[model samples]
Each structure stands twice: as structure tokens, then as C-alpha cells.
Target chain A: MPVWQRIYEEINDPGFVILCAAQDTGGEAAAGPIFDAANATFIQVVDPDHIISSAFNFVNVPSAAWVDEQGKIVRIDEGTYSKLHELGEGDTKISFGTDVYSVALKDWVAKGSDSAYVQSAKTVTGNIRQHSSDQLKADAAFRLGNLFRTHGYADKAEHYWDLARSLNPDSVNFIRQNLTLSEEGSAGETFRDLMGDYVKSGKDYYRPLDIQSPLQPKDEDR
Target chain B: MAKAMMAYPELRHPFAEKPIHAEGSTTVLYQGRSITLARTGAGAGLLIQPDDLPGINGFTLKPEGACYEDLCVPIGANLLVDQQGEQWFDLTGFADLLGQPYVADSEQRVWSFAEIPAKRDGMMLDAMAPDFKVTDREAQVVSMADLKGKKALIVTWSSW
Candidate 1:
């Protein structure tokens, strides 16, 4: 979040805006402090219903869409990262993210349609995930669960949430959001196992980034 | 064990147990909006008042059909039902006609509906942004239409 705030400041283009949404079912209590710590000046949304994710058909967090001035989606559904980040220390340290996506974003903001990073409408539409009937029902079920959760119907909430997971087993957002309620937490053994199965089954947790970094060239390009 | 990133087991059921709505009222969830209707027709399916159509899903009762934007769904026998002396719009039936999925808890009189398929046609064909309305931290409503002339990056992240 702080990283996004930094990037938003660096871009500093009045015409460019970043709407960062927290897809946390825990609502503002869980996500508000993080945004405040980042000093986010751009649009900040604390979405407990995961409305943004459902709007874009994103199965996981850290996903994004780049909408141009015409309200057309120029780039979408990518695992967006402003820069490389590391956590912990010593052998237990974990590292993730990339610095390249931020540079490409800046290019798009400055160059608009002329930016090589901007994809064609055809490609953008092609990249969008086509959800099935059951998957659509899953969204409804998830919202039903959220409604129950909000109203203190814990039993009903659990039931519908379980139903949602069964209807759309591929939704990592649902999986992790459900796990957040458990004692082991979201990144626990269950999440790791599900991610393992996801990889073993040849499913992409995120769509591969199409932009190429100028610093690292492919063998063919080199 | 991996360190827990954004766990909140304590916040799971923090709110006190209470009924979802008043005894006679019905709650409808659509596109992230929760609308509680004070009056409805009695039936196993959701039969909302014709006048409450626009607030629920932005469709209005017209002479031609239930109209929204440029698209109109011709009124069908199952869509508009006549119960006794009242005319109630069958919302669940309309959802079925539109292939819009929904989950209903009849006991609680709550129904949650997914995005209407017709509304997403532009996004599927032309890569247009879907119509979504959400509120910012300051409680100002924001919609895709609000970002018309500016380049916007709408990103989703979670604590977990």
C-alpha cells in the first residue's frame, strides 16, 4: 500500500488516478489502518463484499485493470506490483514482486494510446476470463454469505460460503477470504496446499505479464 | 509454519447476533447494494413492488418492457405477476430470463444476485469497463463512469 502511495506520488499526473481497493471481508476495521499508514491520497475503497474483484472477474488479489480515458480496458487482470519487496530476514526470508510493472505503468500514463504497454482492444477482451454459469452462481452465493456475516448469522454465512467454494473451486479470493476466519490464518498450510495443487494442475494463479522489461532481454530479442 | 499474513479470526463474528431485517421486510442484494423493501407480494419467489425496480437493479417499468439504458426486456407473463389486486414484478423470474444467477434464502427473505449478463456485453465484446458502484473511505460514491476523462488504474489488494 505504501509502495502504491509512493508510485502515485511519483506519477503525479493530474490526469492519472489510482483507485486502490482493499478486498477484505473484514471491512474497514482490517484494511483502514493499512491505507492510513500509507498516507494514500488517491481514491481508497474498503470493499468488504469484494465488489471490485467480481466486477473484473479476478480470482485473486493484487490484480488490476488499466482503464483509459475512453473507459476502455487497455490492460487488465495482471499480478500488479510496483516494485520488488522482501520480508523477514536470514534463511526464513521471503521475496516477491517486480520493479518493471511500475515503469510500464508510468509509460502508459505519459504516452497514453501510444504506449507500447497498451494492448489492443481485441487482446484485452481476449485476456478477460470467461466465467461459467456455476461460477456466476458462486459470486451470488459468496455475497449471500457476506450478507449473513454482516448481520451476525454465522451459521448461514458458513453454509453459503462453503457452497460458494464448491461452486467455484478456482477462486483463490474465496479460498483465502474464508481462511482468514480460521485460526491458522490465510497463508497457513491449507492455503499452501491449495496453491500447490493449483501449480501442479497447470493453472495460473495470475495471468502472465505481457510487458517486457528493458533491462532483461529474451534470448531471441537479444 | 509460514507466518500468518493478515489473519483476523477474532473479527470473524464480531457483530452481535441479530435478525437480518425486520420481520416483514425483505432484503435484496445486487451489485454490492443492499436494499430492504418494506412491501412485497406474498409468494415463494421474490415478488418486489413494480415501483422499487429501478432502485434494486436500475431497470424501470415501461410500456414496452422493463427498460435500462438502451436495452429493454419485453414484459413476460412470468416477469410481471398479478396477485389479487396488486401487480408485483417477479425479480427472480426476471433473473432467470436474463441468465443472471442468484442465491435466495427464503427463510430469511434475502436474495443475492450476480451481475446481469446483458450489462456485461460491452465488456465482453469491446473491452469496456463494467458498471460498478462502490463507496470510498470518505463515503463518496464512485463509479466507472466517474473516471471518464482520466486514465485510471483500478487495483484490488487484500490484507491476507
Candidate 2:
């Protein structure tokens, strides 16, 4: 976010803007600090209900949708975040779509449609799919669990959240949040540890992004 | 008792800004003005007045059925709640009738309803973005329409 804020600050005067829809179910009080700390003043909002995620078909956070000036979506839920560098000191580290995404974003802002980064409409629609029935079910479970968890109903929260996890096991967010809801469900481990376990178990939690000429015809057609 | 809990700072979670339940029989706070739900008899479902249907779940009854946008769940009087001749829709029964998944905890007095799977069937693989609304830090509501004229890069992320 801080990374995008820097880019947003740099080019916003030219009509290049960044808007954020935070996925914190707790809404503003919980999610505002990061925006503030990053000095991101451009239109910031929160999606406690995960509306944007379900609508755009993006499952994870740090995902982005690029819409052109004409209100057409140029790209929906592509790899965001500046994968430019390691996040922490030494062993405690993180890698994101830093330089690649930043360079691509700037190219779009500077060049618009002429930029090679824009995607074809067919490819855009093709990338999304009818999420499995379980995933749709998971959305409801997450909604219910989020409500209970926010209201201090620990056990009730666990019931639905655990249901969410079972319904959509790849959602690490659900697992981390559920672990805190009940002792029986608790892992008392960090997100890194649990995310590692998910990886070991062969859950494709992180999406590998291929953003080059995303609009071009599929290889089969060409 | 829930209100009383909200009144006490120590009783409330230090970070939460809103109460779970409002101070009347007409509301359960999850979003917006909250939903109007009444406990009808010793049952597993919630009863919402037909006139208040839209606010409760965005379902509007028409000549055909309980319609949402272009989709409708065909319902009849059989699904209506009855208490001394006054009637409302049985939320659970309506969902069950439509074959949609839902969960209600009578003990917690809370429930959740999911979108009909058919909606996803229609929505999946569509290129157009689904319209959604959210609030800024100042509590002002913003919708997709508000950003109509400009190029937008919408990022969905979290602090945790």
C-alpha cells in the first residue's frame, strides 16, 4: 500500500489515481491506520462484506483492478503490490509483485491504451470463472462469522468461521481468523507458519501472476 | 443486556465502533440501518414484514416471486409467517424452499443467508464489474457510479 501511495502521489495530478477497498471486516477503525500511515489520501474505502472480491472474482488481498478513463475495466484482479524488494530485515522477509507491477502501472498511467499492458476483453472475461459451489457457500459463512466475531460472540463466530474454512480451505484469511475464535480451533501459530503448512499441503493459496500482453489472443488461437 | 454491555467501556471490545444489536425489536446491526427481524413463535427462522423485505434482504415480491434484480425466488403464501392473521416472510423457509444454503443459530439469535448459486452461474465469466458500495473514513457512502468518469485502479487489501 505504501508502495502504491508513492506512485499515486507521483502521478495523481495527471488523472492517475488509486482507490483502495480494504477487506477488513471490522471496517474503518480497524483498517484506517495503514492508509493513514502510508499517507494515501486518494479515495480510500473499506469492504467489510467482500463485495468487490466476489464481484470481481479475486480471492486474495493485494489484488487490483485497473479501469480506464471511460469506465471500462482494463484489468480485473491482477497481481498488485510492488514486488521490488524484500519487506523485512534478513530472514523475516516477503516478496511481492513490486518492480514488475510498479513499472506496469506507470506505463499504463503514462501511455494509457497505447500501453502494451492493457488486456483484451475476451481474456479479461476468460480469466474469471464460476467459482465452485463451495466457494460461494464460503462467502455466506464468512459473512456470518465476521458478524459474530465483531460482536464478541466467540463461540458463534467460530461455528460459522470454521464452516467457512471447511467450505473454502484455500482462504488462509479464514484459517488465521478462525484460529482465534475457539480453543479447539486454535493453532496459536503465526500466519507464516500456517501459510507454510497450506503450501506444503498443496493448496495454491498465492496466485502466480502473468501480466504480459494480458489482452492478446490465447496461444491456441494464435 | 446487549445494550448494557455496549454502554460499559470495559465490557465492549476496545476497538469495535458499533454495537451488535440495536436498542429495539426492529433491528439487528450488520450493515446499513440493520435488518428488521422478529422472533415468530419457537422457530428456526426470522420473520420480516413483506413491506420491509427489500431492506432485509433486497428481495421484493412481485406478481411472479421474491425478485432480486432480474432473479426471482418463486414464493407463495405457504412460506409466509402467520401470527394471529398478521403475516411476514419466513426467511429460513424461503431460503430452504429455494434450495439455498443458510445457517441460523437460535442460541445466538443470529443468522446468515447466501446469494442463490444461480446468481453466480449467471455472474461467472462476465467481464463487467459488479457494482458495490463502501464508506470512507468520514463515514460517507461511495458507490461504483461515483467513480464513473475516471480511470480507476482499485486495490483490495488488508492491514492484518
Candidate 3:
């Protein structure tokens, strides 16, 4: 929330708006305190059932889709950074995305649709892959699990979560939320155990935007 | 005000009550609707009763195809797989062929289906944003339509 608030403040004049859709199935009761405490001035829409995730074809949170002033999705990346990264920040393992995302976001806001970050329609569509059969099933399972978990049926929730994790073994996002709920508000040791495996696997785990692609630079085009 | 779900602990499908089961048959709830899966008389292959096939997944078995209105996807002999001279429709396998996604917990006998994306073939940018209603911090209802014509940097996030 701090990161977003900073970005929103930086580029609000250029018609840049940040709409944070909190995907908490527990509704406001679960997500309210965090945003309320943040004193966020930007738009905060509580996504009760994850309608945005299902529509955007993204499975996890902290994932952002860049929409242009015309309302077309310009870019969608998982590891969207709020601040430019500094040296040793990677070692701290605190920030998610690199400095490139913020740079690109500002470029888009300043240049409008003409920004090189604005991908072609074909490219955008091609980049957006539909969820695989298993992933789709996992989405449903996770939804069902979330419903049960929030309703005090931890045992029942665990059953569905096991099925979801089995079907989409790589989905740490789904697994993390479930574990956090059961572990009395902390992801705890289960998160560490899962992270160990996740790191060893070394898949495209974060799914960051391809930063190497050239975008308009302030001085000249890269 | 929406009552907390736990306030109604007894909530369940009306048909979720105990039902008579055929010999050697297992029950699975499809979309919260109960249906029995019976094993083929020959080698073990699962089949939904012909009469109950429509209820299984809303596919009306038509000679033309798995007819749902005018759209009939021809599953052909592929629809019914034969194992050891006994024909049975493999529910799991059929779902894969249709590109429909489903989640099943065999132990709990629950199967859930998800909607197939209608616009995946390269119209994402041109496609209009899907509208949805959600509540603000004050619990007042708001919707995507309320912000029409404005660009939104939609962020999907979790507090954890």
C-alpha cells in the first residue's frame, strides 16, 4: 500500500490511477484493517470473490495489469515493483520487481499510448494465455477452499486445498493463503518449507515482465 | 446486511440428503448436484447412467453430437470409450477433450466446473472490461460500471 501510494502521488497529474483490488474472500473484515490503517487515498475496491483474477487470467496477488488511458490493457506482469531497486535490495529479498517496471510505468503515463511499453494488440493477446485445464480446476478448488476456510470449517477447507495444491503444484500463491489462514495469521513454517521447494525448482516463479524490451527513455530510446 | 456464512451452519444443497445407491455404485456431486457413477460390468470403467448423462454435465446426448442447443461438439466414438468390450463414458477424460476444466476430490465425491473462456482467440485488447460489483470499506456497493470510460490500473493483491 505504501509503494502504491507513493506511485499514485508521483503520476496522478498524468491521469494515472491505481485501483487496488484486494482479493480477500473474507471481504472487508479481513482486508479492511490493512487498507484502513494505510490511510490510502486512492481507489480501494475489495474483490470479494476474485472476479478480477478470473477475468485477468492471473492466479496470484501483487500481480498488476497496466491499462492505458483508453482502457485497453497495455501490459500485465506478475512482479510489478513499486520502487526502483537499489544494490543489496535483492539480498534483502524484500522488494519483488525490478526498477524497470516503475520506469516503464512512468513512461506509459507520460507518453500515453505512444509509449513503447504499450504493446500491440496482437502481442498483448498472445501474451495472455488462457488457464490450463488443471489450473482452471485449481482456481475453482481454491475458491471453494477459501469459502470454507473463512466460514470456520478449517478441516473442510484443508481438504479442498490439498486437492488444489496437488492439481497445481506450482501455485505457491494459493498454497500460501491457505497456510497463512491455518497458521494463526502467519504463513509460518509451512511457508518456509514451500519456499525451499519453490526455490530449488527455479521455475518462472515470479513471472516478471520482460524488462529487456526497449521502451522510450527520457534522454533517448533504449 | 449479508449474514456471516457460519450463521447458517446447516446450509447445503437440498438434495444433499442421503439417497439410495445402486449396488457397486459411487456418488459424486457435480456442480453441487448429486449423480451416481457406476462401474462397467466388464473391466473397471466409470459410466454415468444414460438417463442421468444430461445431469452429469448438461450435455444432451444427441446423435448429431453432445448437443447443447445448436452447438453440438461431435465426440463420436471418442465420447464412449470401450474397455474390454464394455463401453463407458470416462467423465474425467471427456472433460479434457471438451477443454472444460473441473476439480474433483474422489474421497469427498465432489466435482466443480469452471466457465470456459469465450474470448481467448486474440481479442483481449479489443474485448470490453468485465463489470463486477464489490463493496467499499464502508460496505457500500460499488461496481466497475461506475467508473466507465476511465482507465484503471487494476491490482490483484493479498494482505499476506
- What TM-score fits each model? 0.95, 0.78, 0.64
Give the chain A TM-score for each candidate: 0.94, 0.79, 0.78
Query: Per-residue alpha-carbon lDDT of model 2 for A4-99, expressed as tens digits?
Result: 787787676557667788776555665677788888888788776676665566767777788777666666655577655566776878654545
Residue-level error in angstroms, candidate 3, position A92: 6.5
Instruction: Give a tens-digit lDDT track for model 3, residues B62-108.
Output: 77767654456677575576566655666655566667676554444
Model 3 vs. true fold: TM: 0.64
* Number of the top-ranking candidate, with TM-score as the measure: 1
Q: Higher lDDT: candidate 2 or 3?
A: 2
Question: Residue A100 of candidate 3: its Cα lDDT?
Answer: 72
Q: Write the per-residue lDDT of candidate 3 for residues A1-222, one digit (tens) a residue.
A: 777777777777535567787876555666777788877777787774465666666666677777755556666745666655454445665534556777777777778777766765555565564567777677667656554454455666667777777877766566655544442333456676777888788855556566563543331222
User: Which regions of candidate 1 fall more than 4 Å away from where they truly are?
Assistant: A88-91, A215-222, B1-3
Residue A61 error, candidate 1, Å: 0.9
Interface Cα RMSD, each model: 1.1, 7.3, 7.8
Docking quality level of the chain pair in candidate 1? medium
Complex DockQ per candidate: 0.78, 0.33, 0.22
**lDDT tens readout by residue for model 1, A1-222:** 999999999999999999999988888988999999999999999987888988889988899999999999989998898888999999999988888889889988999987778887888888898898888889999999988888889989999999998998888999998898788899889999999998899988798877666643122211
